[model samples]
Target chain A: MSDLLEARSVSRSFGGLHVTRDVNFKLTTGDRVALIGPNGAGKTTLVNLITGDIAPSEGQFFMGGDEITGLSIPDRVRRGLVRTFQTTRLFANLTVADNIALAIMQRKRITRRFFSSSTELPEVRAEWSEILSHLGLDRLAYRKVVELAYGQQRLIELAIGLALHPKVLLLDEPAAGVPHDEAPRILEAINRLPSDIAVLMIEHDMDLVFKFAKRVLVLAAGRLIFEGSPDQVTADHEVRRAYLGSYADARRPT
Target chain B: MSDIAVTHVPHKRNIPFAQEAAGALVILALGAIGWFLYPDDLAFLTRLIGIAFLVLSLDLVTGYCGVATLGHAAQFGVGAYAAGIACIRGVSDPVALLAVGLCAGTVMGLISGALITRFRGLPQLVLSIAVGQLIAGLANKLSWLTGGSDGLSGIEPGKVFGVFGFDMYSRTAFVFSLGVLVITFVVLQRFVRSPFGLMCRGIKDDDLRAKMIGVSIYPRLVVMYGVAGAVAGIGGALTAISTGVVGLDSVSFERSAEVLVMLVLGGAGHLWGALAGTVIFMIFEHIVAAANPFHWMTLVGLLLILIVVFAPRGLIEPVVLLWAKFKRKGSAV
Candidate 1:
């Protein structure tokens, strides 16, 4: 099967400090991959490269097949490559429905309208309602984003990403800062994501990562060191030595 | 940015057109009261209508889009000249003059907005002021066409539907202006609640998030600027129609700064706030200048300081809070 997204030998550096180096990956339809690493493993930089946030120093990215290196962020998003921020970036002063509705309206190409009310539009409400309720955020439809819990805001972020009709969604730490009790609901929401599209999630929580990802990619010092099933990832000696030493040691069959 | 209010779109939408309808009624009532109270000062009332247009236009970019602009008078002035010159060169129909002003204002808006939207924060403000100054300089330089600093004169409007004339008492001017302002308010009332306005508000809150959602922020800001220009241009045309002349002061730096003051004083985002600010500032300026010509500015300044101190969000925010509070209370009780 053709890859939905492919990054070829992507590498980026700042002066002498290398941020990403010779990273390569491909995602096919329905792939649920978790990218885990230490704090500066250039995980986000790789996602940025894929989403066209930052240009690669020496490699290229392709959506389906065509080169997307030259495309602007919006163009990339238009082609169904979308990303959520590590920190929740939402329209704080706007209501939850309006926030999700913005993406729906943009997708419908009705955002240029002047005569009809944006919130009153039935089509817009329908799209946002489905997306919000899919993540169980239908109750937050009228609540301002500011009044939402951090967990709810994170879900809203995912809702916004979903609203763009993404074929390949890049989620940067989907459950970061969420309370432990609320984090599972987020995991459930992530699990509830439409199964047809490919998802690459950057996460530090191994439990959530192990639970959510069918396949796993481990990065250490700017390069992907291991790519396999979650079981194999924990068994790999190099991944253990580079970053997952304690976790792997604890799980080892002595 | 712990308290980042970059995306602060204030009003919530629940009842659809009901809120806008009530706002329209309040404006109409206020305009009517102004008519009765200022029977002898209809000229001042007409001037109030003109400046209100500038404030409304400013609210679109600065309030909705969060695009800072200090030199908005570029569109306003260019529009005034377009209408005044059209009338002088014999485009005497009131509606036609307004169209000319609108076209000119839209062009100026597009040109300046295209450049201004490229920058953010302080640079955007600088660029806007630069554009405004550039247009004003061009007006001064093109002396034969614009009559330099002396102003453009001999503009004779051919009346509303060729029936009512602009008499010395300024009765027709005030009524005609009121009609135009009311219609503009209704249209804009619907407009701010439109998808375009909502999208712009989203862009205002966090443009990066907006981009991630497939929005092209630059073009949206420019188009809004063009819309603002159309309204401001009509305002300029009204000035030409009612006063029978357009002057350099119509597009002056002071006028731009004054409109900003008025918009900020009333509130930046809300449509009603724009109108209220213009009315309050203009009437206060007129009345205080007439009664206490020497220290009128002092009282105005004091009033402004009081408002800004007590209501940093603008005078309208408190009223909006009270109204929202009242509504919540009504629902509960």
Candidate 2:
């Protein structure tokens, strides 16, 4: 199948040090891929390159066979390539519903209207409520984002990404700071997404990776080391020594 | 899903009609009060309204969009000169002058916004100040067209809809400016409540996230700046028409800073803050200067310091807070 999103030998360097090496990657529609690595593996950097947040030093990016390396972040988002940050980034002063409604309005191209309120429309409100209920955030819909707990904030971020109707969604550490008890909701929400929307998640939590990701890609020191099924990843010696050695020992049958 | 009751929390779904009606009534009351109290010095009150418009325009960019500009007076000056030049060339209609000023202000705003949005934070502030100075210097150099430091004169606005003439008593000018203010305020209220205005607020609260959500930040800001410019231009045209003069001081750096102070003092972001800030600052300046002209500057400086220390959000913020508190209490009862 033709790749919906492709990174062709992408390399990004800040001065003398290379952060992301010539990393060639591809993701097709309905693909559930987990990119796992140790700290400094350049996982976030690759996500940034694909999302058009930063430029590659010696390569290009394509979305459905069209060159998108030169496009701005918003331009890329318009083409249905979206991402969530490692740290939660939200309009702190705005309500949860307003934050999601803004994404929906922007998607509909009605955010430029200078007289009408977006929330007053019945269809818009229904969609907002549906998304809020799906994410279990309906109770706090009117509350400002700043007042929500950290896990709730993460869920809101996910809701915002989903609101864009992205074709390929890159989730950068969705469960990074979420509490242990609340992490299941994040995983459940991910599992609940429609399969047609290709998802590429960068995660350190092995349980989530094994449960949610169909294919696993391992990286070490700014280069892709392995790409295979979750079972294959755990058995690979190189991946074990380079990254997953500790997790493998913990999982071995006594 | 069936077990959980979907309790709908009341949201601010639309603009409150009662609040709008009260605002209109307040504007009318202010106009009547000014006419009654300062019948002979109506020109001074008219000029204050004009400055209020300029400050209101500035609030749209600096307060709403978080542009951090310090050279909005460039648009004001451009509008003033545009109106003054049109009048010199025999476009004596007051409405025509206002239209010319609006167009001029928009063009200037677009041109400056292009340059200003290229940088962030401190550089943005510097670029705006530089743009203001550049326009002021050009006006000074091009004396043949602009009338240079002698200031543009002979701006005799015809009449209100070819009816009431602009009399020497300043009655007609006062009414015309107040009418313009009321109309602009109403339109701006509708505007800031719109989706575009919400997008601007989103940009202000978190620009990166706004972009991530697919908002084209630069163009939105440029369009907002243009709208702000047109408003500022209207004020400049009013000044030229009412006073029969346009001066270099309209576009000076000090004028920009003064308006910024007024906007901040009244509070930024909120529309009523613009009116309150301009009125309070201007009245204080007038009273203190009348009492002790030499030390008025010191007194004003001291007053600003006290305000900054006490009401950092602006003078109107405290009243808004108090009103919100009172409403919460009444609703609880």
Candidate 3:
């Protein structure tokens, strides 16, 4: 099958320090891949490169075989490449529903409207309801994003990403800063997402990586060390030594 | 798909109809009261209406969009000058003059917005102030065309549609300005409640998130800035037409600062706040100046300090809070 996204030997450097080095990546439809590494493994940088948040110092990016290396971040989003931020970037003052509704309106190409309220539309309302319900955020729909707990805000971030109907989603630590009890709900939300969409999630939680991602890509020192099934990833000596650490043996299934 | 529960979710829509109607009613009531209270001061009332337009326009960019600008009066001056020049060259129709002001304001908005939006926070404020000062300086320097420091005089807008002549009593000017104010307020009311307006609010609240949601922030702000300029321009044009004079003060930094004060005093994001702020500030200024012209500035300063300390959001917040409380009480019953 043709890859939905491809990064050909992408390398990004910040003047004397290379954050991403000659990293090649590919994602296809229905692929649930986990990207795990140490603190500076350039996982977020790779996602940024692909999402057009920052340009690659060298190498090219493509979406469905179309060269998108020159596209701006919004243009990339328009082409169905969406992402969630590590820091939970949300419209703090707007209600959770309004936050989701914004994405729906933008997708509908009706945000430029000057006379009508886009939220009053039945289709937009239905879309927000579905997305919010899937993330189990329906109860907090009317509340402002800032007022919600960090865990709820993270879910709202995912909801916003989903609202765009992305073909490929780049989630930068979806469960980071979320309480342990709430992390499973975030995982469940990801599991409930439509299988047609490809997902590349950057996470540090081994339990989540093992339980959620079918496939796994491990990064070490800005380079891909291993790409395999989650089971094989845990077994790989280099990955275990470089990233999994002592948790590799402890996390192994009998 | 089966897991998706299709509940009958009642969306929270901005009820602009009632809000806008109330706002319009208040403005009209003010006009009526002013007409009756000071029948001989129609000229002052007309000037108040004109300044209200400027404040409303400022609210769109500064309040809603969070664009830190102090040179908004540049567009006002542009409109005033455009209307003044049109009258001098014999385009004396009120509607035609308004159209000229709108066009000039829009162009100026586009140019200044393009320049100012390139920076953020403090730089934006400095650039805006600089632009306003530049326009004011130019008006002063171009004395032959603009009448310079002496101010552009001899502008006589013939009549309202060639029917109602401008009388010495200033009644025509007052009625014309009231009509303009009502029309502009209604249009702006609809605009601020629209999806485009929501997008602006989004950008204002969190611009980075706005970009992440595929909103092209710079261009959207520029468009908003242009719209604001056109509105401010209309105000300036009204002043030129009603007073038959356009001065460099129209583009002065002090004028920009005064309008900013009016908007903040009323409340920034709310459209009604513009009218409320302008009316309160102007009336207080007028009353105090009459009482003690020299020390009026002192009272205004004290009032601003009190407002900032007590009602940081502006004077409208208390009314909004009370209205909300009243609604809650009624609903509870």
Candidate 4:
């Protein structure tokens, strides 16, 4: 399949520190990719570069063929490049439904209608109800985001990402702060995302990476060292030495 | 998940449908109380109405959009001068003057908003103060056009609609100001509950997330600044028209600070809170200033301290809480 998103030689550095270095990757429709890396490996930075949160020092990113390096963060999101934070960033004071409704309003471009009630708008009501319900969060719709459990907030993050109608969704550790037992529900929600959209998850959880990602990309010290199927990732000698060596050897390998 | 009929949300939605109508009624009721209590002092009430617009406008940018400003009177002053200049040049109709004020305010809002939205937090606040001082200075310097520091006079507004002439009782000005306030309140109430307004709240709550969700924060804030400007402009125009004079006070730095005080006194963010703040602050100021001519400042200071200490959110939050409690008790019974 043709690429939905492509980052060509994308690199970023803060002063002398090379946070993201010459990382080239392409995501096709329905691609399930988990990006695994050690601390300071620039996994989140790569996501930021693609999302237009930070600019690349040398390289360009494209969505379906259009160079999006020049676009603003919101404009890139408008073009269907969306992401969720490692730490849940939600409208903490607003209800869950309102948070989801904001994404829906932006998607439909109804955020400019200034004379009607937002909640009573039939289209908004329908969208949030459906989206939240699908994520099994309809029960928490009226609750303020600040009042929600950490795992549920993460689920709301996924719900919001889904609401944006993203073509390429970058989830930066969707279950990072989630309790051990509740992490799977978040994974379940992640699995339930629309099939046609490409999903790139930045995760350290090997079990989740194995289960959710069809292919795994390993990064170490700001470089793409390996990109292969989950099975092949452990077998690659260089990949084992640089980063996944101890974990892979411990999990089930030789 | 199959058995869950999740379409119908069970929680009681607090977003009332009759908000605009209810708001209009409340404003009218407030106007009537002012009318009865201070029948002879209609000019005082009219002045309150004029300042109410400024407070409401302040609420729009500061309370709703999350843009901290100390220079809101920049728009209010521009609007006053616009209406006053338009009238002096021959726009005699009251409605026409208000329109001039609205356009001028919106333009001023766009200009100031463009500059102010560039920074966040303290720098933004300082920038707003600078903008206000700049506008007020410009007004003071333009003596030929604005009557300089002496204030602009010779503003003779024709009949309300070319039929209802302003009588000696100051009845026309009071009623007109109140009518404008009620209409603006209803409209702003609607605006606050709309998608655009909610998006602004999203920005106020968390702008980065708003941007991540595809919200263009700058443009929305600029547009809201324009909306806020239009509201403040109308207030300035009303002040000029009702009193038949315009001066440096209209665009003064103190006017910006005082309007903000009023918004904070009543509440910020909620439309009614702005109106409530204006009423409480003005009335308390009036009564205290009357009771103690020399030490009036101390009393007002005490009141502000009391309110801020007891009700950090604003004067309205406690009432709203009590109201919610009262209703719950009623429902329980």
Task: Compute DockQ for each candidate against the true complex.
Answer: 0.48, 0.60, 0.66, 0.79
List where candidate 4 sits over 4 angstroms from the true fold.
B1-6, B11-17, B322-333
lDDT of 1 at B173: 88
Q: After superposition, how far is residue A22 of candidate 1 from its true place, in Å?
A: 1.1
Residues B1-333 of candidate 1: C-alpha lDDT, one tens digit per residue: 343132222234367668667867887788789789879888989989988998999999888999998899888888899999999997888889889999999999999899999999899999988988888888898989999988888888887888987888999988888888888888998888899999888899999999998888899999999999998998988888889878878877888898998998999888878987998899889988999899998998898899889998788898988987887676546
Query: RMSD, each candidate, Å?
Result: 4.7, 2.4, 2.6, 2.4
Model 3 interface CAPRI class: medium
Off by over 4 Å in 3: B1-5, B11-16, B322-333
Model 4 scores what on Cα lDDT? 0.89
For model 1, the stretches where C-alpha displacement exceeds 4 angstroms are B1-17, B329-333
lDDT against the true structure, each candidate: 0.87, 0.89, 0.88, 0.89
Question: Candidate 4: lDDT of B69?
Answer: 93
Docking class of 4: medium
Per-residue lDDT for A146-215 in model 4, tens only?
Answer: 9899989999999999999999999999989999999988888889888999999999888999999999
Instruction: Give residue A193's lDDT in candidate 4 (0 to 100).
Output: 87
Report how closely model 1 matches the true complex, as a DockQ value.
Answer: 0.48
Task: Candidate 1: give the TM-score of chain A.
Answer: 0.96
Rank candidates by DockQ, best first: 4, 3, 2, 1
